[model samples]
Structure formats: C-alpha cells, structure tokens
Target: MKRLLKLYLNTFDGLSREVWWLALITLINRAGTMVIPFLSLYLTEDLEFSPSTVGSIMAAFGLGSVVGSWLGGKLTDKIGYYKIMVFSLFVSGLLFVLLQYLKTVLSLSIGIFVLMLVADMFRPAMFVALSAYSKPENKTRSVTLIRLAINLGFSAGPAIGGLIIAGLGYNGLFWVDGITCILATLLLIQLLNPKKSKVLDEVKVEEPYSAYKDKAFIIFLFALFLFGVMFLQYFSTMPIYYRDSHFLTEPEIGLLLGANGFFIFLLEMPLIKWLENTRFNKVILIWFGALLTSLSLLILNFTTWSGILIIGMFLMTVGEMIAFPFANAFALQQAKKGNQGEYMALYSIAFSFAHIFGHKAGLESVSVYGFDNTWYIFTAVGVLCMFLLLILKQFLKAKNIIS
Candidate 1:
C-alpha cells in the first residue's frame, strides 16, 4: 500500500505550484457545472421542447463556443490570459442566471449562444496559462492534473445537481451554477495576478493568424474534431438514452454520469505516469484511446442493461484518460513561441465544433433512425478517426514536428 501510494505521489511531484492553483481554479469553476449536464433534460422535460429542438439549442451553444475560442485566442495575445478569464467567469455566470428567465425557443437559444460565447472564452486562455506554467517535460501531466481537478469537481456537480433538481427543481440548478461561477471568479482574482508572474513576461506576442497557416496543424485540428465528435456523444446523446429509454431518474442519471468522473479521478494520473515510463508512443496511445471510445458506444447496441452502461462508461473514461491530455500536450508542443493561445484556441475549437456537429447529428439521428443506429454510425466514425490520427502521425513525422 505504501509503495503504491508513493508511485501515485510521484506522478505529481515535478509540477510547479502555479499548476496546482490553476487546477484549483478549474475545480471551482467545474464544480458548479450543473447546467450543461442537465440542459437536455431541462429543455425536454421541464420546458417541453422536443429532443430535436434541444439539440438545436445546444448547437447554438457550440456556435458561440467557436466564436469565443477564436476571439479569446486573438485577445489573449493582446491583453494576456488573466483579464480574459476574469471577464469570462463573471459575465458568463451572470448570463447563466439570465438563461433561467428565458421562455421562448428563440430567446432560450439566443441566451445559450451568448452564454457559451462569454463562458467558453476561458478554455483556450486557461490552456495557454497551463502551458506557460508547466515545464515542457511535464506538460501532459500538468494538463492531466488539471483534468483530474475538473473530474473531481464534476464528480460532485452532477450528483449535487441531481439533488437540487429533485428537491428545488431546475431553477435551483441554474442559481447554484451561477453562484459557483461568480465564486470561482473571486478565487481567480485572489490567486492569480499576471502582473506578478514572470510567466506572462516570457510570452512574446506573435501574429494571431499564424496557426491557421500550418498545414500539418490544420490536419491535426481535423483529427481532433473527429475524435471530439465521437467523444462528445456521451454528453449529448447518452443522457437522453438513459432517461428516455432506460427510465432512470434524474439522480440515477447523475450518479451514472458522475461515475465517469469518479473513475477518472481515481485512475488517470497513475495511468498516464505508467504509460510515460514505458516510453509509449503518444500517437499510438491516442489511436488506442479512440478505438476504445468507439467500442464503448458500440457495446450499447448489444445491451441496455445498467451493468452494461457502467462498463461502457468505464471504457469511455479510460479512453478519455488516454487521449485528451496527450492531445493537449501535442498542441502545446506544436505551438510556436508567443502563439500558445492561438494554438490552444484552435484546439478548443475542435471540441466546440464537435458540440455543434455532434449534438445536432446525434440527436437528429436518434430522432430519425433511433439510438441503436446512431451508436453504429458513431462506432464507424471512431474507426475513421483512428485512421485520421495515423495520417496526422505520419504528417508530423514527415515535417519532423515530433519524433
């Protein structure tokens, strides 16, 4: 037991204090993330919108995310990451409250779009900050540490959100989520001041458009988009499948979703550390992760048993543990000096675009063809993404971007 504990502790030993602070900030922000997980349920069950309409509204959120990520990257170069994060946190929190009051379909859709635009600006900026705060050797581990914090908080959020919805209803979920965002903003103000940190001083500003011109990077971005579309179905379609088909309660769904976070929290850091020591090829890890993610969804076609759902979630979480942090580290390494924000923004857009395409497509497929067909289609998508990642690997090798 002591030896195992020491090994886990070693995974976190080399990271600087700033990375821990960033993780704390992420933890606080994500702990209040009650809205997104339950948004489909809120729209469908509470607001009486159809599944298709919920998907459309969620797509609007994605559109805003693309805009926010682009603008955040551009702005981070000029103003730095600190101010952008603060603005995003406080304003987005305020908007979450406003979202509760929106009644009409058009109004709610617009509210979601605007809310995500302000809210998602923080993502790329946070990644840039994480890259700046970490050593090159420690980049992937640092990102994973931050993800660990996120999952820790996520493990709590939905479980608590379930209780909130059960006792006080959906309005309570919005209020608590908004309050947490504002509190996270306050914590950020107290903990981080760019003027005091030399990390910001080291960043040399560069042309914002430079990342777009790198052909290899653009291909990488496409691969990320494909991987993202497959992964995001967990958020977009899986909840509906649980609620509508499995007849689980809100709390039960919350616990099931929370299980993903709990498993990641317990296992991801140690798993990555072990992989690193084995001198594993990062690209191969990504390919394997994507394949596992596909298999997770594909399993659902064969069984609707709750045990199967647990097993699927575990596989998906394992895939996430392998793919996402390495992907971020790869992007950080590819970034030219002074263009971390731009590179990270492009990376963030992969997930944002996934939200736009994945939710709309998955929900629409469920509406038209049913959930079984949608799972089969995404299983194929996951296979295709593995090939794309292989192509990306070769492109990076030919360009001598990575060994």
Candidate 2:
C-alpha cells in the first residue's frame, strides 16, 4: 500500500503549475456537465420531440463541433490560445442558459448547434495551452493529469446530475452548466495570465509542418475516429440499455456510468506513468487497449446477468486508461512548434466526427436490430479500428517515425 501510494504520487511530480491550473479549470467546467447525459431524455420526455428530431439535434451538435474546432485552430494560430479560451468559455456559458428557453424543434436544434460551436472552441485551445504548460518529457503525464480532472468531475457529475434532475428538473441542469462554464473562465483569468506567464512565448520551429498534408497523421486520426465511435456509445446508447434491459433507475444508471470515470481517476495516471517508461510501441499499446474495449462490448452477448455490467465497465475503463493519454501524447508529438494548434484541432475534430456519426448510428442500430446486435456492431468497429492502427504502425516504421 505504501509503495502503491508512492508510485501514484510520483506520476504528478514533474508537471508545471500552469498544467494544474488548467486541470482545475477543466474540473470546474466538467463538474457542472449535467445536460448532455440527459439531453435525449429531456427532449423526448419533456419536450415531446420525436426520435428523429432528437437525432437531428444531436447531429447538429457534432456539426457545430467540427466548425468550432476548425475556427478555434485558425484563431489560436492567428491570435493565441488565451483569447480563444476566454471567449469560448464565457460565450458558451451564456448559450447554455439560453438553450433552456427554446421550445420548438428548429429553435432547439439551432441553439444546440450554436452552443456546441462556441463550447467546442475551447478544446483545441486547451490542447495548445497544455502543450505550452508541460515539459517535453512530462507531456504524456500532463495529459493524464488533465484527464484525471475530467474523469474525476465526470464521476461526480452524472450522479449529482441525477439527483438535481429529481429535485429541480432539467431546467436546473442548464443553469448549473452555464454557471460552471462562467466560473471556470473566471478562474482561468485569475490564475493563469498569459502575459505574466513565460511559457506562452513563441518558439521557432526549424521545419514547419501542415497537419492536413501529413498522410500518416491522417491515418492516425482516422483510427482515433473509429475508436471514438465505439467509446462514445457509453453516453448515447448504453444508458438506454441499462434502463431497458436491466430496469435500472436514473440514479443507478448514473452510478454505473460514474464508475467508469471513478476507476480512471484512481488508476490512469499511475498506469500511464508506468507505460511511458516501457519499451513497447505506443501504437501497439493502443491496439491492445482497443481490443480490450472491443471485448468489453462483446461480453454482453454472453450473458443476461447484471453482474456482467460491472465486468464490462471495468474492461472499458482499463482500455480507456491505456489508450487515451498515449493517443494524446502521440498527437502532440506529431505537431511542430509552429502548428500545434492546427494539429491538435484536427485531433479534436476526429473525435468530433465520431460524435457526429457514432451516436446516431448506435441509436438507429439499437432501434432496428436490438441491443445485442448493436453491441456486436460496435465491437466490430473496435476490431476494424485496431486493424487501421496496425497499418499506421507499419507505415510509421517505414517512415522511421517510430523505432
């Protein structure tokens, strides 16, 4: 136990103060993330929107994300991450509050699109800020630290959100979500002033790279996109599964989802730290993690027992712990100093694309083919993603990008 504690503590030793502040801001913003988890339910039950309309609104969210990511990247390069982060956070807060008043399908759809467009602008900028704040060697650990904050907030967010919905209804969630975004922005302004900070100073790159022109990186992003499609179903379809198949309550469903975040918060930092010291190829580690994630879904076909749910969630958490931080670090490595924002923006866009297609596809599949077959489809996606990664691995080797 003493040795375990020491190892966990050591994972945090080398990250900069800016990274911690960034992580804290992320925690604050995400802690009030009450709406997305319950968005489909709210639209369907309260607003009496049809399933098709809900699907379209969700798709709009993804479309906005793609646009936001591109615009954010361009702005971050032209202006700086500081301004983008501040503007995105502040405006997005206001939009979240405004979203509650839109009753019509058209108004709500457009509102969600605008909300996400502004909200997702923060992502690529945050990645750029992370790169600025972290030391070269500590980059992956720094990513893990930020992820710890995100997962930790997610662990508490859904469960608390469930209780909030019970007491105050869906409207309460919108207010809390909006307020947290504003509060987080204020914290960022107070704690991490770009003018006062030394790291934001521009560094010259001997060879500048364009993210769009990199063939290998495109392949990598495609693979990440596939992985994201499978990963994101936990938000869209799995909750419905828990309710329909096992007859779980809203709070119970929240607890089950929260468990994934809780496990990652406790274990991912140490796990990534240990993996970083190993000789294994990062892509190979990612492939292995993808396989585990696939099996997590595949396990559902074998039994009807509720105990299987715990096992599935555990495997998925471990797989996420292994895959995500290294994937982030690899994306950062691909960027030259001059194009960090562009590269990370494309990286963010990959997952955004997944959100665009994945949730809609998962829901349609579940509706048409039933839950068991939908799990199979996602499992198949994970396997195909692994194959793509393997191709990328060999491609990297041929180019001497990795040894």
Candidate 3:
C-alpha cells in the first residue's frame, strides 16, 4: 500500500503550481459540462427534431469549434494566452446563459455555433498556458494531470447533469453550465493573474515555426483527426445508442458515460507515468492505444447484451488514457517557444474538424446502415488511423524528429 501510494504521488511531483491551478479551473469548468452530452437527446425528445436535423446542428457546433480554435490561436499570439482565456470564459458564459431562449432549429443551430465559437476559444489558449506552466521534463505528466482533472470533473458532470435534467429540464443545464463557466473564470482571475505571479514566464522563440508549413505535423494531424472522430462518438451518438438499444434512462446513460471518465481519472496518471519510464517510442504507444479503441468499437458488434456497453467503454477508456497525453505532448514538442499557440491551435483544429464530420457521419451511418454497421465503419476508421500514425512514425524517424 505504501509503495502504491508513493507511485501515485510521484506522478504529480514536478508540475508547476500554475499547472495545478489550471487543472483546478478546468475541473470546475468541466464539472458544468452538462449540455453537450444530452444535446442530441434534447433535440430529438424535447424538440422532436429528426436525426438529420440533429446531425446538422451538431455539425454547426463543430464548425464553431474550428473557427474558435483558429481565432484563439491568432489572438494568443498577438495579445497573450492570459487575456484570450479571460475573454473566452466570460463571453462564453454569457452566451450560454442566453442560449436557452432559442427553440427553433435554425435558432438553436446558430446559437450553439456561436456559443461553441466563444467557448472553444478557451481550448488552444489553455493548451498554450499549460505548455508555459509545465516544466520541460514534466510535459506529458502535466497533460495527464490536467486530463485527470478533466475526467474527474466529467465523471461528476453527467451524473449531476442527469439529476439536473430530471429535476429542471434541459434549460437548467444551460444556466448551470453558464454559472460554472463564470465561476471558473473568477477562480482563474483570483489564482492566476500572470502579472501578479511571475512563475509562468513565457519563453519567446527567436524564430517561430509556422504550423501550416510543417508537412510532418500535417500528417500527424490527419492521424489525430481519425482518433478524434472515433473518440467523440461517446458524447454524440453513443448516448442515443444507449437510449434506443438498451432502453437506458438518462441517469443510467449519464452514469455509464461518467464511468468512462471515472476509470480514466483513477488509472490514467499511473499508467502514463509507467509508460513514460519505458524506452518505448511514444508513437507505438499511440498506435496500440488506437488499436484498443478500434477493438472497443468492434466489440459492440459482438453481442447485443447490455453488459457489452461496460466492456466497450472500459476498453475505450484505456485507449484514451494511453493515446491522448502523448499526443498532446507530441504536439507541444513540435512547436518552438513563441509559436506554441499556432501549433496547438492547429492541433485543436484537427479535432475540431473531426467534430464537424464525425458526428454527422456517425448519425447518418446509423440511420442508413444500422447500429452494427456503424460500429463496423468506425472500427475500420480506427484501423486506418493506426496505419496513418505508423506512416507518420516512419516519416518522423526519417526526419529524426523523434528517436
């Protein structure tokens, strides 16, 4: 027990205090992440929208994310991550509060698009802030710590969100989400004023590299995009699957989703720390992770027993724990000091682009081909993603980008 405890604590030894604070802020912010998980259900059940309509609205959300990521990157470079984060949190909080009024499809679509545009602006800026705050050697662990916080909060969010939805309806989710965003912003302001604290000094790169011009990075992005599409189905279509196929109540679905987060929360840091100690190539780990994710989806087609949901989710969680932190660290390594925002922005945008198409494709495939076929397609995509990463691994080897 003592050895286990020490191993756990060792994972968090070297990250900066600012990174801890940032993780706290992320926890608080993500704890309020109640709406998006249930958005499709709301569109279909409460609003009575067709699957096609829900797909389009979700696509709008993705489009906003893409634009927001790009804008945040540009603004971070011009002004700084600190200011952009503040603006994004405050403005997005206001937008969420107002978003509940829109009932029509067009209005909801536009509202969500605008809300995500403002909300997602926080992502790239936060990544840049994280890079600045973490020690060079502790970057991946820092990412894992932040993800631990995120998943911990996410674990709670949906369960509480389920209760909220049952008690006050979907409108309640928006208000709660908005209030939490503002609360997180306040915490950020109090704890992490860059001017007041001198810990997170931004290192200026003498010559910043352009992410747009990086050919290898572009290939990496495509691989990352494929991973994102497979992962994101958890939020978008998987719930609907739980509802229609398993006849799960909202709270049950919430708990199932929360289980994924909780599993990650408990085990990811230790797993990441162990992986980092090994001399294994990070890309190989990423490939193995992707392979697990593919199998997770493929397993859904194995049996219709509701127990399979738990199995698949467990596999998916493991895959996520392995792939994501290394991917984040890899993206950070690709950037120079001053150009971190641009590189991370493009990185976020790759997932943003995945969001745009992934949800739509999942829903459409389900509609046309049935759920089993959809899982098959996703499994195939996951396999393709693994191959792309392997190709990238070879290219990186040739360029000596990573040993």
Candidate 4:
C-alpha cells in the first residue's frame, strides 16, 4: 500500500498548476454528463422509442457535433479558451433544459442534436488548451490526465443517473447535468484569461482555414476521422450490443465502457514516449490496428465475463493514446502560424464525422448481422486505417513533412 501510494504521489509531481486546473475543469464537466451512456436505452425503453427511431435521432446529435467541433478550436484562438468554455458550458446547460419538452423522438433528437452542437463546439478549445498547457514532452500524460478525470466523472455519473431515473425519472438526469454545467462554467469564467499562444501572437490578423492548403494535413485529418469511428463504439454500439446479448447489467456495461478511460489513465505516461514523433506513427498505427482487430475477435468468444470486455476496453485505450493525441498535435503542428483555432477545429472534425458514420454503422450492423460481426468489421477497418497511416507516414517522410 505504501509503495502504491508513493508511486501515485510521484505521478502528480510531474503535473503543473495549469494541468491541475484543467483536470478539475474536465472533472466538473464530466461529473454531470449523466445521459450519454444510457441515452439509447432511455430513448427506447423509457420514451417508447423504436430502435430505428433512436438510432436516427442519435445520429442527428452527431451532425450537430460536426459543426461544433469545427468551430471550437477556432473560437479558442480568436477570443480565448475561457470565453469559449464559458459560452459552451452555459449554452449547453440551457439546451439540457429543453429536454423536458420532448413528446416525440423527433423532438428529442432535435434537442439532443442542438445540445450536442453547443457542447462539442467548445470541447476542442478545452483540449487545445490542455495540450498547449503541457510541455511537448508531456503531451500524452497531459491528455491522459484529462481522459482520467473524464472517466472519474464517468465512473460515478452513470450509477447516479440510473438511481435518479429510477427515483425521479429521466428528467432528473437532464436537470442535474445542467446544474453541473452551470457550476463548471462559473469556474472557467473565474479562472480563464485572454491569452494567445506563441504561434497566435505572431499574427494579429484574420486568417481563414482555406489559406492553408497542405495536402498532407488534409490526408491526416481524414485518417483521424477513420480512426475515430472505433471510439464511438463505446457509446453508440456497445450498449446496444450489451442489450442484444442480454448478458450484462447497466452498471456492468457502464463499467465496461468507462473502464477504457481508467486504463488510459494507468498506462498513458509510460506508453506516450513510444507514441511521440514521426518514425513511430506507422508502427504504432499498425500495432494499434492489430490490437483492435484481435480484441474485437476475442470479444466474440465470450459475452458474459465483463472483466474480459474491460480488458478489450483497455486495449482500445492503448490504441486511442497512439491515435488521438498524436494526430491532434500533428494537426496543431501542421497549422500555419496564427491559425491555431482553425486548425485545431479542423483536427477535431474527424470526431464529428466519425459520429455520423460510426454510430450509423454501429446501429445498422448490430441490427442486421450481430455485434460480433460489427467487431469483425471494426477489425477490417482498423487494418485499412493502419495501411493508410503507414502510407501517410511514408509520404510525409519522403517529403520531409514529418521530421
């Protein structure tokens, strides 16, 4: 116990005050995000929604996110992280209040879609700030801590939400999440100041995304979009998969999905050094692809042991650490001086795009074939992504874009 305590203590010694605040902000935001894990179930079981209806409505939420993410990073650059964070949080909270008025899935979907837009728009700003706060050397650790904080909140939010729905019904979760957002927004309003990055400081003029026409950057963004599809599985398909199998309880499923973030917290720092820089990107993508492929297959072997599923979650997290932050930082680096927000927003777009397609597929595939078959599809996709990334690395290397 003492040795474990000492190691935990030593980990934070590497962090800074900025990192601490960033983690706190993430914690507060996630603490109230009580809806997403159970959203499909809530819409279907609670609201009497059909599977097709829920999937379609949920897919609309992804559509909003697409626009939100594209703007989030740019807003951070222009005004400040604080302002963007403040705007996003409060607006998102307000959107949550509208959930009560839903009578049909159509109404609910529009509400969710708009709320998602507002919420996701500022997410990239927060992330960009988190990334910028860390020294380049510790970027992975920084990203990991934020992911951990989110999971820490995730660990609690679902259980509490479940209880709340049982007691006060689905409306309770919306109200609670809104209140949490309000509190977190106030903290950001208090702590954040108008500041610009060194890159931002160089240009005081308006810069549009079109000004940068780097093909490598475009290709890189598409690569990340493809990679991000696997991530949405945590929410989009996994819960439905559990439901179809009827093998796990809500709490167990939450833990299974939420555990990915926890594993990310555990292994990120030690593993990040291996993920950083150019030479490793190709190898890392391939390694991640194989892991993702194998894990999906293993999942088909058993459906009852959640512990095994959690291990699969861990493998996905390892893949995430390789893919997400590296691609983000790479995108950041690719941006021309003075357009940090625009570039980061673009970088974040892959997630938005991923949702539109990934969720659609996760739903359709699960309905048509089976969740196990979807895993097979994911394995194939992972392999294809690996090849594309390898080719990308080689192209960048030949042209010296990655060095």
Q: What is the lDDT of residue 355 in candidate 4?
A: 70
Ranking by lDDT: 2, 3, 1, 4
Q: Comparing 1 and 4 by TM-score, which wins?
A: 1
Among all candidates shown, the one with the greatest lDDT: 2
Model 3 misplacement above 4 A: 1-3, 40-54, 165-172, 198-201, 236-256, 300-309
Worst 10 residues of 2 by lDDT: 196-205
In candidate 1, what are the lDDT values of residues 1-403, reduced to their tens digit?
9998888798898887778888998998998978888998899898999877886787787789999998888788768888999999999889988899998889998999899889989998898888788877788899999999888787778779989999989998899889999999998888777655546224455544478787767877887888888998998699999988789898898789878877887789998888777766677788889989999999997876868888899899999999998888878777744377788888988888887788678888999999899999999999999998888778877877662
**Preferred candidate (lDDT higher): 1 or 3:** 3
Worst 10-residue stretch by lDDT in candidate 4? Answer: 196-205
Cα lDDT tens digits, model 2, 1-403, are 9998897898899788899999999998888766887898999999998988898887888899999998898898878899999999999999988899999988988999898889888999999889888887888889999998888787677778889899999999899889999999899999888876658324457776788888878988999999999998988899999999999998898789878877887888888888888998789898988999999999999999998999999999999999998899888878753487888899999999998888889999999999999999999999999999999999999988872
What lDDT does candidate 1 reach at residue 192?
77
**TM-score for every candidate vs. truth?**
0.88, 0.92, 0.90, 0.82
Query: Deviation in angstroms for 198 in model 1?
Result: 5.1
Better of 1 and 2 by TM-score: 2
User: Please, what are the lDDT tens digits per residue for candidate 3 over residues 64-171?
Assistant: 989899989888888988998999998888888898788998999899988888888899899989988877778899999988888778767877898999999998
Off by over 4 Å in 4: 104-107, 195-212, 234-255, 273-314, 336-338, 366-373
Error of 3 at 198 (Å): 4.1
Residue pairs in clash, model 4:
73-341, 74-341
The sequence of per-residue lDDT tens digits that candidate 4 reaches over residues 34-124 is 8777788888887787887887887877788887887777677768666788899998987776777686867887888788888987777
